[model samples]
Target: MVAQDEALTRRLSRRRLIGTAAMATAGLAVAAACGGKETSSNPGAGRSAGKEEKPRKGGTLIGAQVSDVNMGTGYPFVLLAENPFLNYLPVEPLVRYRNSLEPEMVLAERLEYNADRTKAVITLKPGLTFHNGAPVTPEDYFFGIDLILNPRKYGITGSFQLAGFARFITDMKKVDARTMEFTFDRPRANMTDLFAQLPVVHAASYEDVKNGKAVAGTGPYIFKEWAPGQRLVFTANPNWHLTDREGGPYLDGVEVRFFADQDAMGLAYEAGGLDLILDAPATLAKRYRARTRVGPKRGLVYAGLNVTSPLLRDSRVRRALFLAVDRERFVNELGEGFGTVTVQPWPSSSPAFNPALEASFYDPEKAKQLLKEAGFSQSRPLVIEHRTTQTYVNIASVLKENFEAIGVRAELKGTEATAFLAKLRAREFQDVWVTAHAFSDLTPVTNFQQTFPYQVPNPSFYENPTYLDIIEKLSGIDPLSDEAKRQYERFTQLWLTDPWLLPLQPTVPVALLGAKVRGFDEYFLAPGGSPNFGTIWKAP
Candidate 1:
């Protein structure tokens, strides 16, 4: 009887122990959920967010790319293609687009114009200094404009738009240390937008821009070293016009490394050696996008037509080619992400994008029918010549496959960069060509308006009368008026519908951020993505 009683007591004891353990686990779960603490599904995720992610403070960033690395003259240099993102960093304009895309002051504290809008007077903030501690002065302004006016001095950057101002620019005189006036050739409603984006040149940096003398600038970082076709290094300029109160750059130093190709750029990113890589095409950029914390942003890619080609002489043929290519698969397969397929020289993300434009869709059957109607048969074989650079070679391959599927043949040709530019500029190429176009953004106008159709017999060989006429009309609109808004929308819609462009991949700035990177959120520019090396700090 005593043994039986002892067994019952032991059974109760065991049940009580299990109940206590269950209560402890339930308490822990409730504490985790209520306190908003994660209970380690991966454990590494919380550790990474806790340990690896650090604020950007001060570090030298190394940017990489596959394009030309020439230090520009502020004229038309290869830098415009590859380095303009960094170039525009320091040259602040009087007015800038705020978070809401409204114009706000940056360098200039205030601005005024004549009664007729022909003359704009600007007042710079006092005490602003260049990287070398030179005070901001108007002479530097004249020097910049002078460089653009003389083709030999600086290449024809804004030559076409400036041509309209040639006679009107009666004076680009500095009235005082902080005051300057621009007397235009004619009354321009959007002149302030034009004025705000005139990249300010530092007088001290002229020697470098002129002869590759030595890189110097007014940017947040100094142009410290450049190993041509290799790497560019920049260190902090403490005197850079930045202040936390002003909502400005937050870190120090920048470095840009050049790679032989996108594959190298990717490898560097994986190795954690590069801070940013700019100018990578669709395939590589998309691959990196999968690993990045944020998705990729769309920028512009120029889908050029060899308009001078006899095959493109028929407007129907040109329009038919637009339908023949499968832009969706090209962007998805080659450029992954939530990519936007655009068909204009302008980036759809730009502030200047007229909201009226709707993107075109890809329809292979429609394209086939269009080609057949244009007299291209399975046997006649209408041949469109496509030139190769690197990115567009994929576009051509897609074209060759898709076009052949649609009863068309494309002759693929490869050319060196210099020859390619020359042939296109001379308008001597046949059928099709594609190139990457990087444009600087102003308030209402897209950069590189130099490509706008110049007058017939024009040296630029860009002859699109409709584009020219629209540019003229839009260029003259008062940005503040509703009527101007209507024109902006109309022209933007015209750009997509006229079938003059074939946009491909969106812009993705490539960079492999190291464990040391910091302060990456401070910089801003018109092109959707670029590095903020000034705000980046290295971890100890």
Candidate 2:
């Protein structure tokens, strides 16, 4: 009934699935040798380009967190954990990412998968301890998962990630104090990646963590102090397992100062008060490129349309609305030339990106014709509601003009972060709202999973049983296999055919580091999200 992708044009590449169990096994020796220094998969492979400066640790790194607020307790809360700005510092997961952004052991020493791929044996690194001096055990990991799945006791009622994880996972058992086994209800295509990303919490103090009394994590940085709404401080954990030349957490401490405004953060960065600004403006980033490190964020900034709305229910009207807006102009205005125009939800760098899918060109005349055919006239023009942040208010204004030129009246509805998310989940928009969502990881499956209602329900209300069926088939299949490729191709087609969200552009976030900051590229990266400043050091 809705648009779908064309027949299989090409198969999914094997390179996308290179990090298999065998590859992970091979990385064990290398991981062990580095002492969790976050070395690339290969030995003797260093990411630093210039003359390797030996890391000298001492001073505290004062930086700005991308998010205005942290949950205070990031572990076991799906909403809190999803934002990397909140957890990367205080909450350490079992699977730490490498310089290449590949999942490797941090807390866990070995990850072994069964031949059937339905079960996994995770052997934790021995003698690991939490920030509160609690010895981390397999019981703690299981308890954390349990708390996340059933978090009524923890104050959080429910979450999509928690519900989805509970639905797939069958059981988790402690083999010994250091070893644990996981049995999945169904084999997962990205099992290791998924498990590695989960942040472990101390079972002994789950209630304290749940009640916002204390944060008991095994991360490099310990929760030292919090001023709330102003500044949060973290001291290097003395008992942290991960180590480098300077022992652990190259910096003695990290101070993440929160700013409600980006301009204020930029001022702080320029004044040399802050060490790093992970979400610096494009202009500021360009001005400070010598001191800044830029990377592809692999995220989407788009407008999610309400397909259930009577005015938007028609496919013709939806297509007309997409054609009416100038995505390039919006990117230039809002993203400041640091963004690329995107047609589908997948970024250009993504494996799921379809080059064959023709870009939707802005055609006002054609948009008007389509709208006219849908029975809208001057007396009864199509009314649209656009909700977004003050940051993109200008882009929304331009979008309003674009729509108005095509005989559509657009109204801007701006809201804060929390309210915006609540609106998105409730589908409380009149027509469409300008918003964004990111991939939990680099996998194409995550893109589909986030959009699909079953896995991780998106703001868009569009649903199809056929699309769901194809995604189910993709589960546990080899990424390079013809079956997985076919499923991906089929799903891509379906996504194109039924565009619930309009993909505007790919965001290339800039991380502007001060002169004193070292290991910006080496240790302060989280593949698709914010940088992890665990091993970052300030020049002595």
Candidate 3:
């Protein structure tokens, strides 16, 4: 049986549950005089962070690459309404994100939830349009959900998010062109916010999706050009729906430069050719934060063992491997400072956390004794292979030495992200792999739903029956009042009794922004808890 955390921990170290929308919403309240009884009825139209600072106008932002989704029509099969990562054009789904990071309403004026998390009623801001000049309607929002619901549409397939959503959702009717009434099988507190999950597609183009073409999305910017693996460009939508305080995008275009490795991105950043690098390693982040015009990225690292390995089949053997190494010393090599060693899959900051699970410590002699008892004499070396990347080679090397000292023969299997993840997904190695997870949102269940394979992203190969049960409990759309606490206890018991994934500290990505860059923090954030560079820009 595997350990599971359905209530979700904030950090990835403990294999926590998926996080919900952020609790830290910015209180950028506007003057009551300027504010309306409810403000404009436009999508994402609420008065959020109506900053006194003037919006800068007229410059393209050039930056380095993070993940490789938007360089081209990766989803040519389903014409993407908006590149999930590169959102040069901003739009709304009633609730839009501030800096496009978390859910904040723009289109939908109000989000009212029923008591059971089964249903939600909404009121939208009126006269909202997409970058393509399409007027947004309730049918459009309905079509967005339909895109993901219809398997033939080939959208958000196998998502744990749909685990709850697929249950109670019933019908969406257009109360009027702008006002849509969404009813459910029971009650859904999250329905109005589900758009936070899938990118909204144009209802006018539903025929396109049925015809086997990707639907178009209305946004602030239109995809003008993409040069795969090299450079991609976007021209601002002349008809962009939202503008700055004074209606200014302040620039005509945005460019994103891709590099094969971080070193190249480093070179570009130093040469003042790049504005930001959202995908650098911890070691590199420390280097750049000290020497360059960059900032830190919030990242997580943990030791994940392949449960299928015969050598680690025994609980004693698994526990021995963990006790053998010095995680604190090893992580010191990355220089992100001492990260809170994960006691379990959840972050120590989460409400459901139990600090008692952090007791797993470094004990090499004990590790040696356990292995010997497990029948490993000097005749055989406990072979462990670690997969890694150039960014953390030094730390991986240190990890190898620690395990080797405890009567284990650990080999370095450092590979790049593509190859490394391929091996991970295939479960080809019998040892441990050091990796990080990009949390989807603030919701603990979202985190758990995602990692536990309740349904989003992709299913986990490390699937355990024990974990599956918890998934059923907490992932229920209409969760019981005690479900949160129950899930937390179940997860805590699993970790304290039988540790699965070892916890690690979270590190921030080191992003080097150029002098011309103005909106690095305010915008250019990634969606799904990962880095998204859609709002990034460069000088004209």
Instruction: Give all candidates' CA lDDT scores.
Output: 0.50, 0.60, 0.48
Report the lDDT tens digits of candidate 3 across residue range 424-462: 434565556666553322234445543322232232245
Please provide, for model 2 over 230-333, each residue's C-alpha lDDT reduced to its tens digit, 9 standing for 90 to 100: 77777888766767532557788878887766677778888879887765666676667666555544456676777787767876777777777687776665
lDDT of 1 at 412: 69
Better of 1 and 2 by lDDT: 2
Q: 1-540 in candidate 1: lDDT tens per residue? A: 124324533443333110000011111100000010111112222124546554545445566666554444343222245454445544454564322233346567667767666777778878877766677787776665666566465443223333333334778887888998888766665454344445565765666654544444455666666677766666666666655444334446566777776677778776777655444455554555432222223245545565555555555555566666676676667666434664443333343443222244456776666666677544334443343445667766776776677666666677765456555445555555665543323334434243322223232233566656655665544433444445445454444334454555544343334444443432233222234434455555
Each candidate: RMSD: 18.0, 5.6, 8.7
**526, model 3: CA deviation in Å?**
8.4
Query: Which should have the higher TM-score, number 1 or number 3?
Result: 1
Better of 2 and 3 by TM-score: 2
Candidate 3, 222: how far from true, in Å?
Answer: 3.2
TM-score per prediction, in order, is 0.75, 0.83, 0.69
Clashes of each: 18, 5, 63
In terms of lDDT, the best-performing candidate is 2
